[model samples]
Target: MEVPVMFTLQQFVDAPPSEVVRAFTEPEPFAAWFVAEGFRTPADRVRIDVRPGGQIAAVFVGDAEVPFTLHFGALDLPHHVELRFDDPAEEITVNLTELPDGRTQLDYRSVGLTDEQQAPIKPGVATMLTHLAAYFS
Candidate 1:
């Protein structure tokens, strides 16, 4: 079997790593920042179980309501998280690093993507990260 290409993106947030982690792990902050222009999930609809083998599920309200689930592979508080999803059969790793100036550097990498799959999701991922940055601002 051929290995799929990996897509990676990095962003710097003007907040501490702990705060950044909360944005990713906590329901309210996750819903706040995980939305794009066309996709929005209310905080009440976001359910997160932050542990290895746990899951995060949300119902996105856009032109249509859609449900999404992410299975956790690993969870290291304030530093690292690994998630897997079935629709694309992808593995995503999120790494957080703290800068000396007190900002958090977010490194996001997703593996098991084909060119066709990556093309469309790339822009959405970028948009979500931009929203995340704005949430901190």
Candidate 2:
């Protein structure tokens, strides 16, 4: 049996689509904003290989150093990015659109989760996107 769980979240950032893409693709900006409140590390601690088959290795240091890898399935700069994580096997898609006011609208979707899983992940993604917006402000 499989649990059908998915979530879609939209957020508007006060920056261009290009800048939003850079935040997700580039290592330094990614490290800065892709963290939770108490789980941030220095930019140098993150490694991102921005390509279709590339990988992102992030180190989250709290009580201990926890490392994880996300593999990119597709990458279309300033437009879309699709990635998958191994441990629990989750797939995520990010789509960006430029609005007239020079801001970017982000559409984030994640699939392959249980109801128990979606509860926490949904809010976490929202918070991360909020941080992303703060990075540009």
lDDT, residue 36, model 1: 61
Off by over 4 Å in 2: none
RMSD of 2: 1.2
| Per-residue C-alpha lDDT of model 2 across residues 30-104, encoded as one tens digit per residue | 986788656875678788888888998988878778888899988788899999988777899999999999999
Strongest candidate by TM-score: 1
- Give the per-residue Cα lDDT of candidate 2 at 104: 90
Model 1 lDDT per residue over 1-137, tens place: 55578999998999988898887688998998877667888999999999899999998899999999999998888999999989988899999999999998999999988888888887888888887877886
Give me the displacement of residue 78 in model 1, in angstroms.
0.5
In TM-score terms, candidate 2 sits at: 0.94
C-alpha displacement of 74 in model 1, angstroms?
1.3
lDDT of 1: 0.88
Clashing pairs in 2: none
Report residue 130 deviation for candidate 2 (angstroms).
0.4
